[model samples]
Target: MTFPSPKAEAPAQRFQEATAAARTALEQLVAQANEAGWGTEEISVALLEAARFLNEANRKDPDPADDPAISDTPAKEQIGHGELYD
Candidate 1:
């Protein structure tokens, strides 16, 4: 597997920045919900779920440059080119 070049790092950095922005926005929404007394059981649960999902996503490792599962062989050289319905 080929590693990513330094040029590829820009997109990852941008994604991290976007994620941080989204988290900040969501935190503001949570605070607003609290101040507005909008925490019904369902709304609270939904908010908790959203927070959990975002936290879990942020905790994950960034995507690796090379994926081991991919083969070096060209696609045309691989088998299984026949029609599926045949």
Candidate 2:
């Protein structure tokens, strides 16, 4: 099935700019939420829901790693430069 496209197409730089703007807006939302007395659980839940929405929107191809068992299992190796933090 084909998906519908928006009226305007965003270039790579435009997409990057949108990402940065969304990130900044989300950060400000977190700060406001904290000031409004939202706890860690509430904040994290909101963030996770937002992430899920983004994943659903941006997912073009099937990702086999999202299978039940694989998704639930702990990662044996680092992702990207995970060792850099250690």
- Model 1: per-residue lDDT, tens digit, 1-86? 22233333588886776676666766677678778887656566897798798778666834434435445655665556553322
Q: Candidate 2 residues 19-54, lDDT tens each?
A: 766777777778888999997579979898988987
TM-score of 1: 0.37
User: Model 1 lDDT vs. the true structure?
Assistant: 0.63
Measured with C-alpha atoms, the lDDT of residue 67 in candidate 1 is 38
Model 2 residue 44 lDDT? 71
The Cα error of candidate 2 at residue 13, in Å, is 0.4
TM-score for predicted model 2 compared with the true structure: 0.43
Clashes of 2: 0
